[model samples]
Target: MATIRCCTCGSPKENGKDKKNRIEMRKKTKGKTPRRISLRASLRASVRDLLHMKSKPAFVNVSFKTDSSRHRFIQEEIAKYGKGNITSRIFTYSELCEATKNFALQNLIGEGGFGRVYKGYIHDLHQVVAVKQLDRNGFQGNREFLVEVLMLSLLHHPNLVNLVGYCAEGQQRLLVYEYMANGSLEDHLLDLPPQKTALDWTIRMKIAEGAARGLEYLHETANPPVIYRDFKASNILLDENFQPKLSDFGLAKLGPTGDQTHVLTRVMGTYGYCAPEYAATGHLTVKSDVYSFGVVLLEIITGRRVLDMTRLSEEQNLIRWAQPLFRDKSRFHLMADPKLEGKYPTKALYQALAVAAMFLPICL
Candidate 1:
């Protein structure tokens, strides 16, 4: 992996001691409630209901900063990354074409609304990677391409997909990522071939835990918190060891900060995973991601797609189908995937169902 200097956008400005802190300091000298609780102002308290605090994140110092245009911001941040010891490499279009066998169909591994992704081997790095070639005709595709590039480039985490490099030669925009051998969680979790072995309860829990940590890092640790607008199974890729890493940052948004409560943006995300509040109003918050995480958690436990038209009309929606099961604790076990054949621990299943149920939105 090429070295990307992952740091906050701007220099941190210290807050001056104000009247409130002065008074609090007096009280503290007198040995009462401390004046200033924390410089970050109990950041977790606001989203505690959704996030449920457990542990502190690895400390990295970076404060929130924004530029006029997202494109300019991406360019600036990436430029900063370039000053580091080993900067992100800029791959030529022809180099990537050579790697992917001239974009042949046989190497294709994944496709989405953005465009097609193919498995390729880069000779320079002598490493296998996934090359995502963006749709040339779509203007939005270009913006998304840049956004994904900026996000993966700036943000580095164990649970987030690594961006090996990118090819922006001419009009060709493509992203090179570390090849995920196990494909997506959706590949093995939801629909499985008759011959494939089902994912055990332990692995399912581990995947959920890793995914949740990735989301939590975005929400709590990023310089300016990031709202992962799109959180679903297909977006969570698994590695050779079944370790889950969150992917696809095109839909991510810089979350609200200071006094701001949420970000306002057009509704976008996989249908079944969109938070009801986000769908009803464009107000996007870290909780928007938490809600989507809940949906995925349910999917992990049940091994069902968020939406399926082929299913019975009532059960087509996974959340709604889970309602009665949540209401009746005795029936919670029924929500477990039948393919498991009752191998999961009973206590763990109940706790998982409860936590998943808690993640769901109140009205939805």
Candidate 2:
């Protein structure tokens, strides 16, 4: 009998004898587990979430753009199969309109470069949900829409946002997700209303740790290893208990593997959070995300915006303001968020700062 490896369990046995064992293992570990799929030769550009703008689109006439025929091929495949084939619930445009009260302005909870997000109630599921309505002319297009559907449909983890359903009818494109009560880390850390409670040292660290674990899952557990091209505080959503979940798969890229150095692609991300090397060259690697994660970690420690122009020129950039202090252990206290009111642990502060330094680019 020939020896064969079980794809799901990675156990080896005589091909005919363990066939039943393989089926048993798969049945026992159903939806909660991930399927082990092999990596493709190259990831399609349409699979990436490229931020488009009027003056400066995320991707231009770059070399990485997929061939026109290939782009159309994917579009046709998605159109023919539709959302019903993807295993994610499919919602008609009218059904979503009803769920979100006809998408009234009052239901709108958040808006960004891509589109407006609305809070909705789904009676059938007896659950509250977040509905993302993509702008036809905004940064996200049909490619971005399909990419998100496919990515979220395949990837599942505790720290990643759950895709409940999606709407694709006529010209409208929308995504439905499990409602995040606390909103994003950006809301808790950067600007807060007078009565809004501030995140303490412990809560901030917990959120950071959860966000890091989510990235680790994508980078390590996922067979192809996803690179979160746009890793920032705003993308990290929090539930009722302040647990963090990474959202917005629009800019995510599949990491290079098997001795490959990096994948060359267009530089696409927020200005301040982009890694310096990635910005200089279109070469993207797992470290590109690590660099952005560091910036977010720094923001959590200091309670400062990544790039605030209102501050003095020297202090406007958070990284620039904290670099000198990172060298002196005594001044590490200065890096703590003023809102923290000096209540954070001294030793923990040092350890967090040390982690931030590891992510930042070193002077050569």
- Per-candidate TM-scores read 0.77, 0.80
In model 2, pairs of residues that clash are 49-250
Model 1 scores worst on lDDT over the 10 consecutive residues at 1-10
Number of the top TM-score candidate: 2
Per-residue C-alpha lDDT of model 1 across residues 88-184, encoded as one tens digit per residue: 5778789898999999999999987778999999997999999988886643354466556656766778899999988765556788999999999
Name every residue pair that clashes in candidate 1.
24-35
**lDDT of residue 135 for candidate 1:** 80
> Cα deviation of 144 in candidate 2 (Å)?
1.0
Top model number, lDDT: 2
- Summarize candidate 2's per-residue lDDT along 1-364 as a digit string, tens digits: 0111111112232466577787798778754564544222112222332223232212233122455543334434444434333567888788888899999999999999899999999989999999999987799766567667766776788899999988866667799999999999999999777798889988998888888888877776665677778899999999999999999987776777567777788888899999999999998888888888889988999999989998999999998888788777788899899889998878678777777787886321
Question: What value does the lDDT take at residue 212 in candidate 1?
Answer: 82
- Model 1: lDDT to the true structure: 0.73
